[model samples]
Target: MMLEVAIKHAFGGFSLDAGFTAPSGVTALFGRSGSGKTTIINAVAGLLTPDEGRIASRGTVMLDTHHRINLKPHRRRIGYIFQEGRLFPHLSVRQNLGYGAWFAPTPAGRQDASRVVEMLAIGDLLDRRPGALSGGEKQRVAIGRALLSAPELVLADEPLAALDEERKAEILPYFERLRDEISVPILYVSHSASEVARLATTVVALEAGRVVAKGTAAEILGDPAILPAGAREAGAVLTAHVKTHHPDGLTELEAGGIALFLPTVHAAPGSRLRIRIAAHDVMLSRERPEGLSALNILPGTVHSVRPGDGPGALVALDTPAGRVLARITRRSAQTLALSSGATAHAIIKTVSVAASDVGAAAAT
Candidate 1:
């Protein structure tokens, strides 16, 4: 599916002139809070009308200011999941989900109630009311409701923003499962680098209401020029296969012929996983250092070394395990005589990689 949106609008002294196209899988609209992420999503959802341009999905034009074509929110086959679950207080979980399906213009008559229920792991909570469920459970119910509607696309606007850290963590795997299992494409809006790293297949980076960048996850997220949330978030996301689980509760991952040790995860052997190693966590050496605490040592040549945003510089290394970036002080970089094409070893500690920082590397 292809979602094309081009919109122009002004509100509260803020001007929004945004446009982008998203292909199949999850395409994240990423930026700061006021960068017009919601404005574009609303336009696509038929909630806001643009002064000009059109919104189309899979060849069907939802809104066209030039042609004077605008579809009502209900008429547009798009499912919206807000930050809050917004379930009816009086309605049971099943009832709330049923309402979503009931409102669909052309319901999937052969209801896949059991399938959705299992997919979201909400079968146990079906009889409970919204007031009785926890935040994560409520969101799961909400997602199930949206899926049951059988919409052509799902628009998620900061779906995890309102949840606490634990709740957010609890819900992330489910989101991943939905991405892998659901047929409908998702246009996810988020400001979180971790979430985008884990979930997005494509990314449309917005800045001051304009699309500053758009590309595949690896292409966009791997760019050192793109500002990550923090130094710890600065790194390339790599796709690797789970080689095996260790007795010490760690899993060995194989990426581009290199082995990465991570915390034991639910993924089994041969299953793919995404891992991110912070640039700051990476230490470069001229030669293989002996007796180091760091478990992973990669052999690579310096691809490029360039000045970074803050006081440090970004050194791009072409490793057997794929490209990795290391952030080092300018002084250290100069002292090491670092330059493009220099051979080096990237040393990374095994425990420095946290579970929250790792995402599924393969996009659905």
Candidate 2:
């Protein structure tokens, strides 16, 4: 599914003139607070009609102000999951899920209760009421309810924002499963960088109600100029296959003949995984450093250097492992005589890598 949007609207003191395209899988509408993420979503949802614009998904027009086409929210075949689950406190989980089926204009053609329960791992909580469930469980029920409606698209606006870190981690893999296994496209809104790194397939980045960038997760995240930490946080995404697990609670992965050691991941050998390496954590050496504790060192060459706003520079390298980025001081780069096509080695300290930044499953 492809979603195309162009909208113009003003509320209070905020004016939103934004547009973008979203491909299949999970497309994240990412920006800081009040950047018009919710405003654009509301327009597509038919909750707030834009002053002028077109919103189309897979050739179906959800809103076109010029043509006067506006489908009612219920008739749009779009499921919505808010930050709060919004499940009925008085209803059992089963009944709440059944309510989703009842609201569909057409029968979902027999609800797959068991399938949903198993997929979300909510079978045990099926008999409980919303008040009796934990935050993570309630969110799972909300997701199941949305899926039971059999929507062509699902819009989630900061669905994980209300949860604590542990709860967020608990619910994230289920989202990954939904992204990998479900057929419907999802439009997710979030401001957290970690959430975008973990769940987005395409990223539509916005700032102050305008689109700053839009593309695949790797492309957007790898651009140093656009990252929050500027050159410091810019990094590369490597697709690897699990090779084997070490007895010391670490897993070794192979990508293009290069080996990487990660703090034990859940995938079995041969499973493909995408790993993110931040530029700040990488150091470049002209010759292989001796007696260093850093475990992963790969041969590479300087690809290019982009000047930054201050003392540091964004250096891109083509490594045997894949692409690796490094942020080095101007003096360090000059002393090393780093230039395009210069052969070098990227020294990555495995211990410097944060466990939370390593995504074990698919990322947006």
- Tens-digit lDDT track for model 2 on 170-213? 89888888878777678999887667777788888887788888
Candidate 1 local Cα displacement, residue 44, angstroms: 1.1
lDDT of each: 0.84, 0.83
Best by lDDT: 1
Candidate 1 lDDT at 222 equals 69
lDDT of 1 by residue, 230-251 (tens): 4445677778899999999888
Q: Give the TM-score comparing model 2 with the true structure, all chains together.
A: 0.90
How does each model score on TM-score? 0.94, 0.90
For each candidate in turn, give its C-alpha RMSD to the true structure in angstroms: 1.9, 2.5
In candidate 2, stretches whose alpha carbon ends up further than 4 angstroms from where it belongs are 11-15, 108-111, 228-233, 360-364
Clash pairs, candidate 1, are 274-361
Best by TM-score: 1
